[model samples]
Target: MGHYSLGVDIGGTFTDIVLLDVQSGDHFSHKELTTPDQPELGVLRGVRILLKRCAVQPQQVVRVVHATTLFTNALIERRGAVTGMITTEGFRDVLEIGRERRYDLYDNFLELIEPLVPRELRLEVAERTEPDGSISRPLDRDQLLAAGQKLKTLGVESIAVAFLHSYRNPEHETAAVQMLQAQLPGIAISSSAAVVAEIREYERFSTTVANAYVKPLADRYISSLEDSLRQEGITAPLFLMQSNGGLVHTKEAKRLPVQLLESGPAAGALVAAQFGRDVSETKILAFDMGGTTAKLSVIEDGEPLVAYTFEAARQKRFRTGSGLPIKISTIELIEIGAGGGSIAHVDHLGLLKVGPRSAGSQPGPACYQKGGEHPTVTDANLCLGYLNPDTFAGGTMKISEAAAKQALDTVAKTLDMDTASCVPGVTDVVNENMAAAARVHIAERGGDAREYSLLVTGGGGPLHGYSVAKKLRLRRMLCPPSAGVASALGLLIAPPKVTRVTTFSNRLSQIKIDALEHAYQELEASAVQTLKESGASSTALVTRRYADLRFVGQGFELVTELPAGPYGDSTPDRIRELFADEYKRVFAITPPVNDVEIVNVRIDVSGAADAKLGKQRDEAATESRVPVRRKAYCPDLAKTVDMPVHQRANLVAGATVAGPAIVEESVSTLIVGSHGSFELLENGIIAVELNTGDRA
Candidate 1:
């Protein structure tokens, strides 16, 4: 009669699974190379292996939460379902005529995300909704049926129905969906209003198309995985992590898979926030670097920032407006240079470049002996002796130093340098790439990197955290006890959260408070219902209100949380002040005018949370442990040094290990530099404090 919750995350390079004892706070984790051809197979295998190792019965699992990067990769790689679009007449070309703004004007052949539905498959239907939430011309069931029949004949797996101004009045979109579902029972249908009930028809259309694109894939994967788990004797209720860093029922995820685009990375950010608050560090930069990519998120006041709109499948990783606009609530993060498996190659200009591309799992880093001929960050670390070949991945993943050196030697010959020189270059270039991108993101938010501690997680984060922090001039870093599988742990720690949004435009001076209150109440009820459907108890539900506001003539809006409200006469003034404060916070200037307008209203409801992450340190029973000497390359000194190596398991609370040391765990390793010291905090966090003089 044990209470256990299982969490699993599938990444581009690896699949991570964790089993937590909700009663005793004990946990066991496992990692393996991802089976790209069938991502869920790897996760299923990893879970079985972990449960077997811990001698726990599969039936003991009472809850299961899963997150994966499969959806995001599918969208970026254009591997999603074949989808068709059924839109209002003359607006069928809206997907092609997006925004009409060039992301990069100078490039003649600039690549943009291709419309998910080809023009041939984008059929037109006769229907219209007025701008003011009224039906103008509607009830063209014949045209809608004709379009559905044509799409089915074209062999489309799903269809997106988006009519102009559907966000304001959804009746046309809803009626069209019902008609399509009745005629084409086999096809999945997505409505723009149901997916994104906000302003801007272009973004709504794009997001609806995206949901249709991923629906078939998610349905197949989730249903298959659930059946497989049940056959394996684990009859737990299954849940999924969404991009907004919240858990949702499997049904909800399948119905709206676009929301899961950043699920895996979102969990990492959540775990970082939890650890940030545990040690009293309210502001932190969460750095999660895995085999294929590194994701950076900012946590302020012990919570990760949440954004409603973000682009996907960008041609330029850091450039705004270079990708398909996706309107969904997401934990804001900037993804840049990849992790250990990121390839390193000399550019045509004779300069070395670390990755936006990676070797991934099929042929990971050269050290993995998996047929990869390219040198990668992991290969460089292995060649430099920072990674212990005998202890990597719990010694389950065998690595070859000779192979790593051979890969580095090839890159060195091109630069007319020795392998030793090229090894450090790879690590340095990758660190700089990550730091540079992170700096831009932090600065955009008006934050200084030096003012925040770097909370590092993932298989490769700890190995490079010190270098990245140094480059950013950060004074401190934190690598928690179970950093490698932090995402899976987060799935257990996260609560079920539901978000509802609507377009409600009105100038501040002329707005109706009673109408606004009515809108908020409706939104709250919808969100609360969704939470309940996700199996959350109603008693402890918490609701938060937000407003997307802007100056009267501004094109974009700033999101601000509304003060708790039974909103009344006084609420408008308070809201106006909040909008002004937020505007100033973002722009660092007084508002151009006191005239403000509310563009949208949003509500978020969070269910009861049972945080299961371990709070107590895994301390040694009685004795203190000593470190053994190991020779590893020192990047700062540009030479090899005999560094003190210690097993992370043996380190107790309050134990301090000084510079030029190695802290090794089965799944990950931490390399402390000569300029800093690693202190084991009472809360099981390893705080890396750099010497103040090192800034010189």
Candidate 2:
């Protein structure tokens, strides 16, 4: 009997499943069109297909890991359960006020994302807790009951309770939850402290509300998936990928679905980081361009950057403070609406514009022949001969070149240009858009993108990576095997981990070693419990501590790692020195007279999973294979050229191909520009090195 593991990643346009043999290191993958109405349908379909193809029995699968963009879709589509919020009396408008900062300071009519909970649904209760965790006013049971009754009358399916200072003392919020659960039986309720026990009330409240809004939907979906899997005789443990590139059990995922908002993207980053580690590339730019969005992240020192906060459903895609802020640990990445299914059209200014809107799986692109009329990035790729019309989706899903031409023709007529001319423009626009976003993202992180190697993943990533990399002046790019479904691979590689944080506001000089130790002990205990519940063994657990520190009066804090120890009087000084070092590294200067304050304490507990899989070494090709030549539109040359098409499977280690070529794989295609060269590495990765001096 052979043991195996299954990983599934559900995206907007496709659900990808990968089955890995634990002992043999064999892997098979399948991609199915996503059913937006019920994403699990696509997941199950892909899983069954992959299993049957691999001849693997359900019982042989020992672990099942999954990642999805369902919660994020729901948030963006405003399709979550009808939700209401209950907050401390005077803070009912915190979600709306949101620091009163405009994302676009110059735009007179700048619009912000509408609050998920409207003012009418944002009720207030009479309760108060001071910043020091002292009760200033007790919870008024009558007011809470009244609020519950009103919420019930309003037909709210879920409720969120966010009392001010609940991060320091959750007792008031806990009492309110108990009362609401009793008064409003069968309704889903979430408390801010339980969701994010950190200082910022607005961010905490928003995160809790977001969680509650999606809780019912996530619970139902997860239950349905489990039941379906059981019926299929796959009774393996199910784990969900989190936004922080960690794995959490399905039960915990349902309780905190907000943590899974960026789960799929995070998985891509994790895989990119792992690939970087394997190749000894410490600095990498992970580029994931799927059917609906493009995500970019920075990986340094074998780890993806992690941020303590994220914005969801931003009105301005590139602008901060334009969305609902959620206080949760997440892989720091920049996402833009640039993907294969992104619709293209001529804007009011008579200029071609690529999307922020996607056709999704239902309509897909015009080439899918599913009655979509609009031209899309995929259609442009097809028209430009970048995609295979006959062998698309491994020949299972046929693409219609006629449909693609017609769609592009319609858009070209609007621009008064030929379809061939318009095709390159579309591709160039989307690539430049992604490159520009990546540039801004890297620059903001205090790094130059040109200094990093690009690791491309996702269905469309390889197809567009070279062009984007060229725009960023990047000289090297890598497309690993199974790049199209890298997120699913990432699920298997991720560890079972939990991160817990609590608000601890104290000046460094005023901090007591005993109090600090106690706080960490509580956090570690909670993490241990979570890891146990997630099926990780206690013996394999590892714990690390960090504190969010800043000079007094600073608006934000930098995370500083702490040493594990039995606290002595010298510990405070040691921590202060660590903070100073980090501060200097980030800002290039540390204030000599400024007092440092610790605002939040975080503890991360992780347990390594059995991620060992067999590797198959690639042998050198026996002979130099002749490339199939095809007439393809070359954007750099502004004309059609005979481009070499090489089947990736036929290439072996040390196989090198040069210039204006297409490396075709069943799942994706890698386009080498006029001045680029590609070599197959021993590990089955295609390493494309570009001449930076070339125009294309």
Candidate 3:
């Protein structure tokens, strides 16, 4: 009996499926337009296509990994189930109160984010837990039971349990849950301590609410998907991609779906990091422009940066604290509503705005001929001659160039310009928007965009990589094979992993090593259990640790990786040295007089698995000499030129292409600008560099 692995990624516009023969390393991919009415429709369709194309029996599939933006979309669109929250009596408004600090202090009109759980839905119970994990006050069992019944009567789909200081001690929360289960068995429940287990009250409360909001939907979807797979004879264990850049068993994922809010984007970051590992000493700015959004992440030293919390459904798209804060260990990335399906129009000032609104897959872009009259980036790409009408999606869907012209002409006529002018106008605006977002995001992270190599992946990424790179004065861009479904492919590269966080808050010198070690042991055990449940083999275990430490008086902390071994024998000197090294890298110097405190400790347990991406073949020994040509817009030269085109399959080892060329693959295109050239690296990467008017 042969075994196979399947990865399913559901996006805003399309659902992608990848089937791999675990033994032979053969793979097949399929893409289907998403059905917002029922996401499972697209997922099932894509899976059927992939399995059919590979002529593989579903029973042969040993494991299935799924990633979706459904939770994220539900939050952003405010389409989640009716949910209610239960918290400590005194903290009923914690989510609304927040820190009370305005992100922009001087701006009086700054909009505040609306709490996910409105006051009406936030029921209070007399229960309290101290920060030290001691029960300050016993939970009112009767009160919690009554509250559960009240919520059930009100037709609440789910309930969030977020008692004060629950991170330190979840006893009260657990008791409350027991009571809620006894009284309201139908309502789904999410506990904060189980989800985030961190110190912040507002973040914890909000995260719990977010979890409650999405639990019902996630549970239904996961259940439906599982049944569908089983019906197709796929008895494989199913896993889901979490925000922490790891895979979790489907059973655990349902219990804690909040960790998967940014699952799709995190998978993209994983793909970028895997690519980065092959290119030594390269800083990567990963660009993933799909149908509904363009996602960006900064990768340094082959690891994507991690963030503790992210806001979703932001009222103000680019600003923090303008949306529901979700607490999870997620690969930090920024998103802009600037993708192929992003709508374009002339604004009130007669200035063109590319988007924050998307046409999406239902009607899609006008070029998709799905009844969308709105001009979109895809329409613009079609009008600008970047997309092939018959070859789009491998000719699976017919693209109407005439429809694109009509849509672009609408914007053009409104602006007193032509479609040609309108197309570039929208394209330029989109590029500038992406570039500006890149600048702000990179600067905040204390990075210079010019110093990083841009790895563009996704359907729309290659189409706009050149222009965006030019805007940022970046000369290099690399597009991987199957870039359109890169996120799904990335699922194969990710390890089975878990990130557990605990708040310690003790001065390093005065810390009780025994208690700390015990905490670490517990966390590690939990992580190992999670991995085992996910079907990780014994040989795959790889446990790593980190701590969030800072000077006693500092408001923020820096994360430092900790050595994992026999915790009892480790010296303070070893710990201090690691802290100092990380500290100096950020602040240039460590204070000799300041007392350092370990605020939080994080444990990451990983189970390594074989990445299915085959090793790079030697190009010189394996490719053809065929080079086709196409007319493309060269922004540097500021004109449409007949550019040499080469099938990526034919570009072998040592193959070099000068500027003003296009490397077309089945999945994506790599545009070589007039100021840069590309060469096939021995490791299978198309290494891009500045031409500087000289060539080897």
The lDDT-based order of candidates, best leading, equals: 1, 2, 3
Clashing pairs in 1: none
Encode model 3's per-residue lDDT on 1-696: one tens digit a residue: 847788888887877776766665555566788898888888877787777766788878888888999999888778888999998897888888898878777888988877767788889989778878888788888888888888888889899999888888888888778778777877898888888888888888888889989999999999998998898888888889999899999888988999999999999999888877777736999999999999999999899999877888887788676787787889999999998899998889998999889999989999899899999998887776677676676445888989988988888899998667667888889999999999999999777888887888888888888888877777677777677777887887778988898888888778878877877888989989888887888576888888888877888788888888556545455777888899888778888645678888889988886556753221122255667676777767767888787766677678666787777655566777788778887756777776433221
- lDDT by residue (396-467, candidate 1, tens digit) is 688999998998888899999988878888999999989998899988888788888999999989999999
Cα deviation at 224, candidate 1, in Å, is 0.7
Q: Kindly indicate the candidate among 2 and 3 with the higher TM-score.
A: 2
Worst 10 residues of 3 by lDDT: 615-624
Least lDDT summed over 10 consecutive residues: which range in candidate 2?
A: 613-622
**TM-scores vs. true structure, each candidate:** 0.98, 0.97, 0.95
Task: Give candidate 1's total backbone clashes.
Answer: 0
List RMSD in Å for every model shown. 1.7, 2.1, 2.7
Off by over 4 Å in 2: 613-625, 694-696
Candidate 1 error regions (>4 Å): 615-624, 692-696
TM-score of 2: 0.97
Q: Write the per-residue lDDT of candidate 2 for residues 349-407, one digit (tens) a residue.
A: 99999998899888999999998888899998887888888878655599988998898
| Cα displacement (Å) at residue 342, model 3 | 0.9
lDDT of 2 at 48: 84
